[model samples]
Target: MTAIPVSAITIVGLGPGSMDDLTLEARRVLAQAAHDKQTVYFRTIIHPTVEPLKQDLPELRIESFDRLYDESDDWSSLYQQIATEVCDLALQHPIVYVVPGHPLVGETSVQLVLEQARKRGITTRIVSGLSFIEPVCNLLALDPFEVGAQIIDATNLAISHIDEVAGKIIPTIPLMIVQVYNRRLASEVKLALGECYPDEWPVKLVRAAGVGEEEAVLEMPLYELDRNNFANHLSTLYVPPVPELSALRLPETLRYITMRLRREPDGCPWDRQQTHDSLKRYVIEETYEVVEALEENDMDKLAEELGDLLLQVYLHSEVARQADEFTLGDVYEHVNAKLIRRHPHVFGTVEVDNSSQVVQNWEAIKKQERASAGVDVHNESVLDRVPQATPALMVAQEYQKRVIKTGFEFTSLQDVYAKLEEELEEIKQAASPEEQLEEIGDLLFMVAKLAGFLKVDAEEALRLANRKFRRRFQTMESLAREEERPLTSYSRPEWEKLWARAKEAIASN
Candidate 1:
């Protein structure tokens, strides 16, 4: 047998819960430690294999960190402390740290010890053994690779960010969560998974795997995960993959659907023929439908319309992806980065008093970004950021808002009204058709500017006006039908009376 190195840490893996599972190298190392009168440290002596190993090696001195578990407040810090103590002991003499299963698998203290030992410049060695994953997988009778299984620590799955839960616990893959050592941890894990998985989703609890007759597997719905008392230090939770059709809630599902719709030969012919330029009008139309849903205050309609708008975005992105210009991932990355970079008060140490200050900071950061990107910041107009393809009223309002920041706006409401009236009169007094068109355009521009000063959305106001006119005209048609007279045959007096009646009926309703 090779003599143990001085001032080194040897971590041994005690194969999952059976005396016969011990590897020859691990047994030799333990015998050597016993012969050398060195104490072997067990991360925890809570496994069925511990007693059998102790019986086999009667002369071996054993020390367990079971007391540390009861004494320490924080598990992370406790693991670090255990690592520190092991490294400190290695500095005095060679130390053996025996952990359940593989030192690298589900053993936090073992990992911590390895890291701390490396930092302290201490020589370290690992003795591999069968991890709990093998026996658990055997009991389930499924190949991990075939099922696209993912293994994660219970603690990580428990405290996973709710918003990022999709990326953490994918529903389309089988999940094996280790170290569900207590009811509390199981409960937290259940809540985290509840974000994406339904309560009726089936899952399994396996206890004392590879421990012969002591092993048990309990199949239950996800909602009952924390309701049972079968959890122990040797327990693992298995979450089967959700059905492929049920994975529609995932963003990747949308991406996949979009890509499949554009796939060659079998793809939708119309979708295959679409280009970015051809899809622009669809995007605009879907956006208006979303606005219409919002204006009507129908949440269900809003959700459906928003999905249509999202489809347009996906279609355009797929087109760009086919051309190899950029991808949906690039779009997300660019926008997410821009949001974080511009919102200094939220993401950085910069302070602000209100949203006004936030807007100021946003513009300043944008200017800095433009300068860094070699854009002509000094020569660029503020109005250049507003898209020309936007609705005419919105474009006009945006232009006015931008220019007003430079003190080019009217000083007061009276001045704004005066300018509006001036433009209106000029349109009426125009001498030629060309002059009349120019004056009318100026009048509408002035109206949009007036809307900005009055703190109203010009586009929404115009939409509301258009809706009111349509509703009142339809009411007039109804009134005309009731009186048995054609709408076109109504005299001026009769038309005035019908309009008044329609306005009153709508107001009463």
Candidate 2:
């Protein structure tokens, strides 16, 4: 056979499902190629319309290549080979390739052929047909332009990408995702969507649209998508926007208080004068109260205290906004950005083998950030990092740790005990009250340091001791009351006898 000069590679779209749906131009191009004895190839003949074409055009050299399953490992390689064979045939004669629906709409094979032919300097022509998108919209009774719709492929939906799109896209707009092939793929889509949309958000599954035996539209929650057990290669997932639930109005008393506090001229004098700095102590105090409630295992109290702590944050942010320094949004942005930056193991390429390395990297980054902000670095001591307003015992413990880090600390527990004894003797020998107070303070500081070396929290240990003393003293008071004698009227020997009884009663309990 002699090679003929190939003029053009014609690409035709064989509309969705029905033969009548094919455009006049598409039919003309396909028929012309058949008359010219050129090769006529159909991308797929799985549709009912193309099935009739095979019977009617038996002598027309019609080729239906739908038997090649897409789930095969070498599907792309098969497509490349098919395109190569078509290009080889075109070198000897003109060739026509037909694809389902519009050739430009998600038709990877058609795109491959066009691109490869262009590189080989072969002319190409594309004939458009009715796409599945229009028919799908008509069936679902949705207006894409009016409601604002986003179309995406189901294969591309991953957890991270879905989160990104969900956060940025307007919540009012609906989403239409295509190419959901199977139940496994549907499950992945559901998992990704659940990140933003509620699990109960309604979704519609559409399959093999515009065909006589096509599946009926199935509606279910996003979470129940996989449970429905209905999906195929032609399936599309439609996610509807969830409507916000109505919230109850605030109580009249609470509303009045909020209004009065926010009032420009008639607000309370003390409330109007407050700023972020003025409310800082209250924020810290409320946070500690919440922590205490949690430790006590009082769920109801914890809930109430947590709300109070949150209100402190809101109040401070509102005050800052009035001062023109920043708003709650700015505060949130800074903290969120800081968290993401500090956790490079979570958000960046930093390789951290363990939690210890993560902590070290975080501290290093924080120090660098502080240095860059022009905060004193060289002259700044670690002790200064402990906030001045922190509880005195906490500050003492923190200060001791800073000094120990600098290799200025005393040796062992025995050495610390000896120093404590020496401080006690000095307190006894002091001539002035101030000197005696200073010696006692030195003894307490040394005790705190010893507690740190022993891996004990000095504040907590002291708190427990105080509670024990209070309980024992309460028992003694109760005993005196039962004995028909007042605690203050008891003699030294009588009080000692009551104290022993209290101890015995506690041990029995």
Best by lDDT: 1
TM-score for all predictions?
Answer: 0.78, 0.57
Candidate 1's TM-score: 0.78
- Give the poorly placed runs of model 2, Cα more than 4 Å off: 1-173, 180-203, 206-230, 245-282, 293-324, 327-329, 336-364, 422-444, 459-509
Error of 2 at 279 (Å): 5.0
The per-model lDDT (C-alpha) reads 0.87, 0.73
Inter-residue clash pairs, candidate 1: none
Candidate 1 residue runs with Cα over 4 Å from true position = 1-12, 23-45, 53-99, 108-128, 140-148, 182-191, 194-204, 216-230, 242-244, 296-299, 343-358, 372-374, 431-433, 464-509
94-141 per-residue lDDT for model 1 (tens digits): 889999888898887777888888899999999988899899999999
lDDT by residue (tens digit), candidate 2, 286-365: 97889778767899999789878867766776677777877777978999999999998899999989999987998799
Q: What's the true lDDT of residue 159 in model 1?
A: 58
